[model samples]
Target: MLREVVTTRYVTPLREGGSLPAIVEADDLGMYVVKFRGAGQGHKALIAELVSGELGRGLGLAVPELVTVQLDEAIAKGEPDQEIQELLLASVGRNLGMDYLPGSLGFDPVAFPVDSEQAGRIVWFDALIGNVDRSWRNPNLLRWHGRLYLIDHGATLIFQHNWPRDAGALEKSARKAVNLEDHVLARFAPDLRAADAQLAPMVTSEAVDAATALIPDEWLVGEPGFDSPDDVRRAFRDWFAARVRAPRSDWLPELAR
Candidate 1:
């Protein structure tokens, strides 16, 4: 279960992504990057962020701490920006928040060198979640305190967007291999085969369940084809569990030459 906090103040809008997540101070007195539930991406994006972020953390990746934030429309009263004020009004209630890392620098491949093993692990993990945003153009990676931290997983688990699909499509999409040509760290990842060997066993049913468990029921409610949020949760858990059990060549992307 995720820790919950109420928004104490609306800090500033983060205009990096289309969803327009913002920096806000919580009642806990911690600063966080809050992803609004009413963003264009909607609740599914927040679901992806929670699941994928927690799953990456489960795999020993450096992802920021995630929390559930309670937002109130009145919190935005002092904001002069009309767009941000409207966004805050729409996002009242439960939203997703990530611990803010101050003074963190955006990752620049030329400026930092990543060793092969760690790079391979990240690539392998991204492939599992079908993350498409981690490219050279927009590497959703942050370098804080000399460590790389993954962020912004709203674009992942795309299959969930169109629920109620046939079993065959689900199977095929789940096993689809990721393309490494435009991946930000493709060149740094030389041995994805070794990464599979090391990380595959770790993506067990327990891990999948743990990650999916973090998803809020509110986010899964009213999902098409599923009678209840638990059903949706079970579907996600089973999908990931089955995907990891498949033959490596079926889903794992090869290291770029």
Candidate 2:
């Protein structure tokens, strides 16, 4: 389980994200950017954040530390904005919190030239997870302390949203062409073949199981067609394992032309 922290105060709302995440102070004396469970995206978004974020970290990517933030309904009483108050009240139990990067800058592909190897790895990783949000228009990446950090994985692993309807969709989706022409790193990703060779073997069943284990049981509960949280975990692990072992470069964006 991720470490749990009690929110001491809600500092301010970050209006940039559609989900309305906020900057909050916690009992641990650390500030976090909290993603509310009350958001329209629901608990599945939080599950994606944990699974994808941990996978990225395991693959040697820089990702923010995550925690389960405990929210109290009383915190909503002090908010003047009715919308924010409603959101807080609805998310009075557990929310997702990411370690706040104070001086980080949004990544701009034009201004920063990334090396081919790193770019290939990033593109490959995003492709493996079926991430559609890392395009140039809304690159969910940050440049902090001279390193790039991945964030906002709530949008990845989209197959989960409809898993109850189509449990077999993951395999089909994994083999489809990735629309990476608009990916922020597309132009810089010169050698995906090399990236696949280097990164694929690292995603073992043990690694996938360990990463999936970090997801909260509450988030896994109520998943359709699953008897328990462990069942859901196994489903995710199996999907990820299949993708890693049988990477379809045919699905990769045609950037080499």
Best by lDDT: 1
TM-score of 2: 0.94
In model 1, which runs have C-alpha deviations exceeding 4 angstroms? 164-166
C-alpha RMSD in Å of predicted model 1 compared with the true structure: 1.4
- Summarize candidate 2's per-residue lDDT along 89-115 as a digit string, tens digits: 989999999999999999998888899
Displacement of the residue 186 alpha carbon in candidate 2, Å: 1.1
Please, what is the whole-model Cα lDDT of each candidate in the order they appear? 0.86, 0.85
lDDT of 1 by residue, 1-257 (tens): 89999999888888977999999999899999999988888888999999999989988999999999999877866678989888878888999999999999999999998889888889988999988789999999999998999999998988788753667776776787767568889878556877888888888878878888888887888887889988888888778866886777887777656
Candidate 2 lDDT for residue 36: 91
**Candidate 2, which segments miss by more than 4 Å at Cα?**
164-170
| TM-scores for candidates 1 onward, in order | 0.95, 0.94
Lowest summed-lDDT stretch of 10 residues in model 1? 162-171
Error of 1 at 106 (Å): 0.9
